[model samples]
Target chain A: MTPHLTARNAFIAALVLALFLVPVYAVWIGNNFVLSLFTRIVILAIAATSLNLIMGYGGMVSFGHAAYLGTGGYAVGILAFEGVTSGFVQWPLALVVSGAIAFVIGILSLRTRGVYFIMITLAFAQMIYYVAVSLNRYGADDGLTIYRRSQFGGLINLSNKTVFYYLCLVILMGSIYLVWRIVNSRFGMVIQGSRSNDRRMRAIGFPTFRYRLACFVIAGMICGLAGVLLANHTDFISPAMMHWTRSGDLIVMVVLGGMGSLFGPTIGAVALLVLEEALPYVISVAGRVVTGHDVATAKEYWQLILGPMLLLVVLFARGGIDGLLASLRRG
Target chain B: MLLFIEQCLNGLQLGLLLFLLAAGLTLIFGIMDFVNLAHGSLYMIGAYFAATFAAMTDSFVLGALLALIATFLVGVVVEMVALRRLYGRDHLDHVLATFGLILFSNEMVRLVWGPEGRNLALPSWLNTAIEIFPGVYYPTYRFAIIVVALAVAGFLYVIVMRTRIGMLIRAGASNREMIGALGINIKLLYTLVFGIGAALAGLAGLMQTPILTASIGMGENILILAFVVIIIGGIGSIRGAFIASIFVGLIDTVGRAFMPDLLKLFLSQAAASTAGPALSSMLIYLLMAVILVLRPEGLFPAAGNR
Candidate 1:
């Protein structure tokens, strides 16, 4: 009710409202495509939230976060291929594997700081990527397709578009809530403080390494959930899901959404996914309307536009869309 | 034994190529304190330039020279326009901005030259194998790469250790503020240093193009290797980068080529076949993790002047 509500709070409300209303609207409009798109947004938002937890809160700039997504998705795909389709079993297994891998990699990589940490994370991720690629049994580089969505003992049908969309929405909202709680909690304060000054945190008698590793594991586990959701959404799993560029995309989401904030990752996910989907259509339409020329061929160059847009944002808007809105509201 | 020697030579050639790329990267980071992720883009551009020029001119040497010059100019221009603003900013800002450059350049390359891989043929003279010993005849082109890389390393050593400009570079690497306070034209120096780094990366890209396939994402894999080298060598230390590049190159090349057979000795053939390639590719990383444990700073910290 208050106009003075901070943009972060406003964004959180809007996201929650959108999550509830979008699928219903999609059903009413009979355009379930909207549900699928927003479902993707929600899944990625969960993934980005995990990244933000470590990067924004814990001060660990991991360049390999997508490994969890890949790991999670592959878990479902591999399990399904081996004829295990139970969502309950598959999801928990994925989360544990991701968390365990993150813990191991974090322990080794956290020994180094700055550029070395970045490279080490990258190396570990690449190691996993190669392993995934070498798994000829699990479809290797070609990827595995899920013939059916996860079975939930008839309690939930992921194959039902509406049910699946709602399931993803619940998870996404739950993740954001979890991130909010953790960031506000004593643990979150310590993580944030460590990010601000790690040496100082250590000097103050905090075992910064353990805290950061724990944060890494949590973030990886959350991303693993996102991976599970993503596999459910697409009914596919491939090593491509964990490619470094995907990690870059996650970083882009965190930065674009305004890093360090609770709701920023969701905003970033919504903005980037929508932009990616809409830019070509909008540009082609504008070209026809303005010049009466078919610019369909030029649609392929849409990423060129994105490249410049990201550059401009990095140069001008350090805080991202949510940050920009907050400042404008303050003004 | 003969095959081992051949693999070792191949490793050395690859190591030298990596050294060329890493030297520039370490130098720029050491002196400018800028983390230019787009350094790999320069390598990509170098390969692209070599392909284009070599195709146009029908002479590999001429093409390589032209590519080198073009890459140097592009490096200087990029430094002037984008990198200059990032000097005083946070390392994160540099990372983000350069990351943007990576996207832009990759797209630009796709726009200019289609995404399909280009094959730049090595000239017949350079393509032939040379008898380095009675039983070991290595690719002449690869030998040339090693020679050129070694010469460049020697030149860099002299420039950094002996010359006035080198003195300034060392000074700048150790402490930028101190060098600036000494009334040096820090801006010009930075531009020159960046240009040199770009040229070195370009040289490696061009030289290795014939032996390695030229493709859109070639830089991506090698870029990670360069980073591993940088991490192992110690950031901002050219000597560290050089040594680490060779170490990584040897580990990677030889490991990939031989680790399956090596693992076969201990494990079942099926297990070795499955695990060998993955483990071999991971050797450099294992080396890096071990190095980090042993020496948080690289093997040879840059001249200790920062």
Candidate 2:
């Protein structure tokens, strides 16, 4: 096999092993809560993967994908608050609304290119955030809570940790698989070709706008699914889910994990959330051992590190972890 | 009728503040072709500086002046240290790097000032209201903001149209390579331009301190509005920014003040109450979308390029 193909297969094998092993390891160590965190990682991985489909493959950088998450979460939260407990209904509603919002926003925003596209998407997300905040009847700025997870015809128990973890795992893997197929399909080739050169794609007798718009909508719908899972996981949905900063965090995950790759978002989500959980304590311990002073508060400033890290990655490591691995394999 | 006039004045005041922000944003984009998201950070810094300096000297005017100078220097330093390296890079790179600076500066502020917002109280002399008409009294400080903003606008007009440096700036906006070919110190010019832009943003922030709460993320809300202004006015066009800022400010202010009542005419009180604020808030963006559809280059594009 060619090294590229060998590298790709090896990466896929490593990911499968890591996914199963990490959770098993968590259980073996009696740190069962890692399952919950990993579930979150899987859910967000789905969201970021959706984002990568458009941003990495279609050259459409949306800085407002968190809106879909919020929309999805709000769909579940609002319905639960109003006594709609069916998973089938709630999930489809989330997808449809997210897609509808994406279609509308993309129609207007896609008219602009580059920075304007980014800014307009951001503005639309902010608009939705404001709408969420204005809903005083549904808890407003504080967010609404799902009294119970969605019911699945009395078959699947969403509240069980193991079941929920596997459910998220299945969805995430499914999303990655779907994205892989979409990116490699004829339509996918058109999208990537548009990313590489939109003018050329247009010149080659392809009406590229519709393809890009469809890609945008699909990505939005996928993120919306993650949002539904997130609400179910947290049992709450707040306007914070859709905040611009949250959108920035998603972009960070996509870039850090390596954009455009199927498993990049999965790896990124795990790494970032884990770092968030562990970094503060680690810093404090390291600080105490070195200087005999408590420095737990340093974790509060982790964003300071992350921001510069993003810059360095952009400037020096444009390919991210996935790119780094591929280059190492080539060498 | 008097209330309408008062609201109009409020709109004008908000417009002037937005113009200060949009002018700087457009200039930086127009001339340097650099997308600086951290421009809002400059606004926040200006407000913080004003609060600190005013407290130290117990004189609002003195504090504001000091804040302006300090913010200008900070802007120049940031340009030299971080932004200079970003020039000629992709827009995405500029966004990422500046976004980093935003994170770093925000944390630094939190470290220095803590999280809670502080009040930059107006001086006693400027605290009183002045009767503008038979049935209307306006805050003297707000009137001062309008007046100062207008003066700056006039000054900006003269600089862009009549001055030698303004000529170079305009030329640079239209064609950077040719101006560089003419042997102008492009780096120095860029730094100066950025410093001036920062000063304008600082002036807006400092002036608004007495009226609004000075806080860590205050620049954020207004930054979006400024972006809207720049988009409506067309990027790189100061005159367009000025006109668009006033229009947006008017639309936003009037829409917020009256949209709920207007909505009540059609929808039930509950629905109107919910949708009123949201729809009104989206008016400016709707305007931007329509503009993008009809006039993608904006009403008055400075560079006039596709």
**Top lDDT model:** 2
Off by over 4 Å in 1: A1-8, A286-292, B303-306
Candidate 2, residues B112-185: lDDT per residue as tens digits? 88888767989887898889997699989888899999999999999999999999999999999999999999
Candidate 2: where is the Cα deviation over 4 Å?
A1-12
- lDDT per residue for candidate 1 within B178-205, as digits (tens), equals 9899999999999999999899888988
Tens-digit lDDT string for candidate 2 (A1-331): 2434557568767877777676677779989788878888888889999999998888787888999999999999999999999999999999999999999999888877877777778778888888888788889899887889999987999998878888888898899999999999999999999988889999999998999999999999999999999999999999999988778778778888888877887777877888888866776787788888887676687666767777788778877778887787679
Model 1: which residue pairs collide?
A: B174-B306
- After TM-score superposition, the amount by which residue A50's alpha carbon in candidate 1 deviates from its true location, in angstroms, is 0.9
Model 2 residue A52 lDDT?
Answer: 94
True-vs-predicted CA distance for residue B173, candidate 1, Å: 0.9
